[model samples]
Target: MTDVVGIVIVSHSPLVAEGAADMVRQMVGDRVPLAWCGGVGEGVLGTRLSDIRAAIDRAWSERGVVVMVDLGGAETNSEMAIEALPPERRRKVVVANAPVVEGAVLAATEAASGAALATVLATAEEAGARCRSVPSKTSAGRRQ
Candidate 1:
């Protein structure tokens, strides 16, 4: 494992997860260990404990891993997967309570900077607030 923290993206749709992972890759490059899992199989839309566990393993690092999930079921399965890991390994994993795509990108960016696991997770969790704070254009085309 690298010195940087790792990241895992989980989503109900395979395309969503892959798209997020691709964004992270484009932004952070390979400086951080990254992995993603979504959908059960054969074009199905669901998460599997085994797949999540495998992604975690693939993204494992001594610095730790932060998992970003798109929905409740993904979060549940990710939690179960973390719990199933050996105690030592499990302690280093956490599920980030942030928007899946944005969180994964931000988390990976932080991790690629060699930030600690806690810092990376915090960055991911803060994504929602950051998004909320952004100025948006109103229907009239004025910033709102």
Candidate 2:
């Protein structure tokens, strides 16, 4: 079986993490294993540090996991969670490059079986930059 790619998005708002998952679902469907962390909403992604860490462990146990954070605070929490895991688990847990929405998707998608987390993270960073370059549609384009 193809190795699963675990994902975690940490942001100031949990919605951002959840939204990333929603977008991924729309683009790639849920065939690949995915997870989320951080968010203020009730049902939005894993909230507590322990939950995030557990998800990472679970995902990694199945295959491996990549964690992406939107900002310093989120990154700190995510990092702490990962650090708290057992040494063996740390090998499976990756602190993703630029840990943003765009990066997470790109990394997760590009990652094949047992690929190094750093490689996927690099792809994510590059993809995020590319995504930023895309122009958004203006209100004038559609009748509202």
Candidate 3:
């Protein structure tokens, strides 16, 4: 596996980001390049632009990179970090719209399978909607 698309996890809590990375690492092994930034820094609870930017740089890949964030501030800060990049490189960074932990797992799987940026992004974005707890959904809203 080439591990084309990289992953970055951002959260207001350092432990959350670290734990999510650990989960993705356990699921995907070393097939995914993982980077993350969390906390306000210095034992505080908040997200910082510097931390997000550093994570982006660390996880960057020529193929592309996807970032999964915990909340609004994380998302906003991640976007700002991407925007700070050169215009050409900005598009390479995508902020995913999915649950951080689950999305990271699916995205890592897709990337490890040598999927392209779009496919990886699609998998992450769609992960939250994937079958969970039940086998399948029926038109009548019953579990199949």
Candidate 4:
């Protein structure tokens, strides 16, 4: 069997992250290991660094982890979690560009295993471009 691609979405609010994950499931049927961390929803919330770390650990057991954050706080926390992991484990984590929904969906729907992380990232970035939130000057920043 092919190795699965793990996806992690961290947001300031778990509701939003869950919503994104739900959208992916709606589209892709949930075969992938998708993990959501951040603010609380039901009983699964990880606002603290430790919570985020645990969530990542849970998601990164089999294959690699693809992380998507909603804002600076979530992004920073995810980054911290990855940095704190052992070098070998840390290699399995990937921080996505933006629009976790699009990125994760594209990653989950492709030939990602046995390939370089860069290839997966490229696929995600392309997916994000396809779902670009209205052409704006802000997008220009990406060129720089």
Candidate 5:
């Protein structure tokens, strides 16, 4: 609906997807179209292609849409949903390889700024690289 790129969040848990969407809404407000989907149904913890497709539809924008997902299953389902879209629509949607919550926030923030779909995706994926670059402490109390 908005000129800015749209954002969609997917997760295995319904609460996680909704919570991440809530954070984006709180921080980004109504600057961009945003939607989220998680779980199969009735408290079940799983991702569904139909749900993802619906979320993408809800968040569709002429500018394009960036999808952030948690877990391998979620990513797989997201990809499947994207593939199901009409060729033109499929071109405008992408599954970002970034942590769901953080990526959704960053992607949404960038999209709200009227950035292009590719730029928004880059912003979201950057979160994953930044997270990986952070040194982790080993059990031996040494940075790994």
Candidate 6:
């Protein structure tokens, strides 16, 4: 568990980030390092690059870290955070395109299992498919 990748959740709402972190803890317990940052000063529903950077620093790990963002602007800020890291450390981080809640939960679980950084990130990315409508069956009952 000590070597597993950590997770950082960046949301437009502080409550959402904290709630997602809470749910992730429920599944992964204390095995994974989870950090979250949301809302600008005074509870505004906005993401601040500095805040995201601070959260990533808090969740830093030797194994790597995966960041999940809930909005387009958040994603842009997340990219800036990654770019801010030294070149050597940048490769170890990824900004997942997965939904915040599902991605955080899946990432935490994979990390707790001591999965490598790539695997943990892949699990989180795959979680996005879960939100898709169920596969439709053709007349032959084969999934579309």
Q: In candidate 5, how many Å is residue 48 off?
A: 0.6
lDDT of 6: 0.84
Looking at model 5, the pairs that clash are none
Estimate the TM-score of every prediction.
0.89, 0.72, 0.85, 0.75, 0.90, 0.88
Where is model 1 more than 4 Å wrong at Cα? 131-144
Model 5 TM-score relative to the real fold:
0.90
Query: What TM-score does candidate 6 reach?
Result: 0.88
The CA lDDT of each predicted structure is 0.86, 0.63, 0.81, 0.67, 0.86, 0.84
Q: Cα deviation of 43 in candidate 6 (Å)?
A: 2.0
TM-score of candidate 3 versus the correct structure, residues matched by position: 0.85
Q: Candidate 5's error at 61, in angstroms?
A: 0.5
Residue lDDT tens for model 6, 46-125: 78889988898888888999999887667888899899988877898899868889889999999998999999999998
lDDT of 3 by residue, 73-123 (tens): 787778889999988879888988777888888999998888888899999
Give the candidate order by descending TM-score. 5, 1, 6, 3, 4, 2
Alpha-carbon runs more than 4 Å astray in model 4 = 40-46, 111-116, 130-144
Candidate 6 positional error at 37, Å: 0.1
Candidate 2 residue spans exceeding 4 A from truth: 40-47, 112-116, 128-144
Per-residue lDDT of 1-144 in model 5, one digit per residue for the tens?
A: 569999999888889999999999998898889999988788888888898999999999989999998776787778889999999999999998887888899999999888999999999988988877642211232110
Global Cα lDDT for candidate 1 = 0.86
Candidate with top TM-score is: 5
Alpha-carbon lDDT of model 2: 0.63
Kindly list the per-residue Cα lDDT of model 2 for residues 15-113, writing each as its tens digit.
777788777667766655677656545644334677677656544534567777665556666778888988877777777645376776676676643
**Local lDDT at 137 for model 6:** 13
Per-candidate count of clashing residue pairs (backbone under 3 Å): 0, 1, 0, 0, 0, 0
- RMSD, each candidate, Å? 7.1, 7.9, 7.6, 5.4, 6.0, 8.0
Give a tens-digit lDDT track for model 4, residues 1-144.
226667777766677777887876787765666777667446554455776788787666456777876555566677888999999988888787756666767766652344445666677778767667743113222110
